[model samples]
Target: MTAAFTVRVQDEIAEKLDRIAALSDRSRANLAAQAIEDYVAREEWQLAEIQAGIDEADRGEFASANELASVVAKYVKAARQA
Candidate 1:
């Protein structure tokens, strides 16, 4: 069972949502629901990845924060060059 609620969106965002609904042949409510579901799923996946990293750390498969910072700095320098 689902409950209905009203929300106020910015004019431009509402217009964009309406266009998306039309293009997808879905009601605006359905499109919004699907988008929210996808967002929740992605968030859960990210949380799982973080948990896995913590588990790896517990197993001694990790680097120190200073080491990680150095690795990140290397990537940042390379990215800036590119």
Candidate 2:
């Protein structure tokens, strides 16, 4: 089942969507839905990774922020020298 809704976009964005639709031989609506679906999937994956990191922190399976910062600084210094 699908529901229809109206949306307003900037002229430039609308024009780009039209061009994409023409080139892809897809309706603008279909392209918009696919784009939104992809965005949602990416966000879900990111949230899962963040949750795993939080769980690891709760379990004390991580380094101190200062230690991490020092390691990062060392890498940055090496990159700068290279």
TM-score of each: 0.65, 0.71
Clashing residue pairs in candidate 2, if any? none
- Tens digits of per-residue lDDT, candidate 2, 23-75, equal 99999999888888899999999999999999999998988899999999999
Q: Write the per-residue lDDT of candidate 1 for residues 1-82, one digit (tens) a residue.
A: 9877787889999999999999989999998888878999999999999999999989999788999999999999999999
Q: After superposition, how far is residue 43 of candidate 2 from its true place, in Å?
A: 0.2
RMSD of 1: 4.0
Off by over 4 Å in 2: 63-82
Residue 2 alpha-carbon offset, candidate 2, angstroms: 4.0
The backbone clash count of each candidate, in order, is: 0, 0
